[model samples]
Target: MLIMKPRILNGMMICGTESEMRYCDIGELHKDFHLGTNTTIDFIMDQYDSGFLLELCRRTAQIVYKDIYQQLQQGNSAVLIEHLQYYLDREGGVFDIKTVQDEISVNVSKCPMLSHITSNGETLSPNIGDFLSDFYGSWGENTPFIISVDYTYPEESYCIYIRRYYAS
Candidate 1:
């Protein structure tokens, strides 16, 4: 007889072998956090104005992208793109990335976060675009790149364009 114990290794949860093995990542944690954060923002919006929510979103973006900002400062742009792809994949996002000249475009057909929240009978913040804009904008600040996000909320899709910039 063999007894298998569940353990966490390299950010994945390992329980058994083959089919019994389960993979886990921070995506789920992020989903929960996003839900809570959105809910809090919604509650606050009732008492405050849109500026407060935008500022909160901007601050959240700053905190979340702080490490990525450091990496960009260290000249690790490839790693940043790779990390973004990996993150979207892990979160079950439907997206495609294309590179043209000095620009890279990421087209997200389906947003995993929105899907998760809606599936749970929750509504996403109407100002979600502001958060995304501030998030990528903050990450690109003082870096050698320009990041922009274009959203089509009715279809729940968006495209992020990252262009490298060089000082002349």
Candidate 2:
């Protein structure tokens, strides 16, 4: 008898040689921090201020994009969005970016982090989504054009990110 592995096996994709790092490692850290798992995810994000979380996102993005915030300051919304999409894809994210004048959106069918964590038989702390939300939100706030990362419903795995740029 042979048992074949499914492509979408739970948590199997994480912590493997094929991928850069085991996303489940973060979950383990959260556990070691004495935080409960498999629940409490929503409470965390709701408690944190969106602006503050977004600020963190901005700082992190600066490092990843190599100070491309300079271009963002020049009101290059499309360029920033394009760069972000590339980075996300390279990092194992599955999504497509759609851009309209002064507005861009990411239609994500599979969120790599969440999928891996759930696959590994663990629950995300509330902080996880909060981190992601603020990060995306912060990305919107970076450009000279005022941008907003809009979260789509049902706000879970198959979520949508809409970033709107109001060019000043």
Q: Using TM-score, give the best candidate's number.
A: 1
lDDT per residue for candidate 2 within 1-168, as digits (tens), equals 112222333644432222222121211223222223223344435666656555656677555654455566665554555555544564467887776764566766666556556656666655665565655555545455444444443344544454444545
- Model 1, span 1-168: residue lDDT tens: 123456678767654422222222342345776687567666767888777766775565445555566666665556557656766777789999999988888898887766776777787787677667766766676778888899855346788888888889
Instruction: Give the CA lDDT, 0 to 100, for residue 155 in model 2.
Output: 40
lDDT for model 1 comes to 0.67
Displacement of the residue 18 alpha carbon in candidate 1, Å: 24
**Which number leads on lDDT?**
1
Candidate 1 residue spans exceeding 4 A from truth: 1-30, 44-64
* TM-score of every prediction relative to native: 0.70, 0.53
How does model 1 score by TM-score?
A: 0.70
